[model samples]
Target: MNGFKKFLFRGNLVELAVAVVVGAAFSGLVTAFVNSFIGPLIALVGGKPDFSDLAFTVNGTKFPYGGFLTALISFLIMAVVIYFLVVLPVAKLLERLIKAEEATERPCPHCLSDIPIKATRCKFCTSDLATAPTP
Candidate 1:
């Protein structure tokens, strides 16, 4: 029971659980948006909002292609939203953070290793950095 409790309360595990819950909630929101807004927009052009009824019979087997198309559209919309709203913004923010972090460090010319910007010696090679070129 102790091990179980530890596993349940582990930081990464808890974070993952929260992420899954949030992702599911976001998926539902995207689905609702597709159903409420995108469906009507498509209907304005296609004359129908619901596509599940569209099917074709082949050898007594029904293929619901319209439903697949509707799902595809929903998936595309979700992908676009996630990419623009989450992925792109996160990427840009990370890039900015990396640049800021990089600005605090400089390469040790003797060892070709990273050292603090104000470092006067190369920790790796024990070489004097007083005359090293500054980037």
Candidate 2:
């Protein structure tokens, strides 16, 4: 019971559950967007709102390639939306954070180790830093 409680309360598991829920919700939103907006846009250009009815008969067997095309378009749109709206912004934010963190530290010249920017001595090599050139 204790192990079960620990597992249930674990941070990673909770985060994963939240991510799954959010992803499902996002998928619904994207699907709706594709159906409502993208479908109409494609219809305007291609004269068809959907490709589900498109199929080819080969050797008395039918292959519906249009559905595959529609799905592929939806997947591409979702990829682009996620990349521009979510991934690109997150990457930029992380870059800014890394720069901010780097600003608070400097390399210890004598030891070539990272130390506080204002440090006057190299803790690792026990070398005096006052005479060292600041890069």
Off by over 4 Å in 1: 94-102
**What lDDT is reached at residue 49 by model 1?**
70
lDDT of 2 by residue, 14-41 (tens): 9999999999999898778777887788
TM-score of 2: 0.76
Taken over the whole model, the C-alpha lDDT of each candidate is 0.84, 0.83
* TM agreement with the true structure for every prediction: 0.76, 0.76
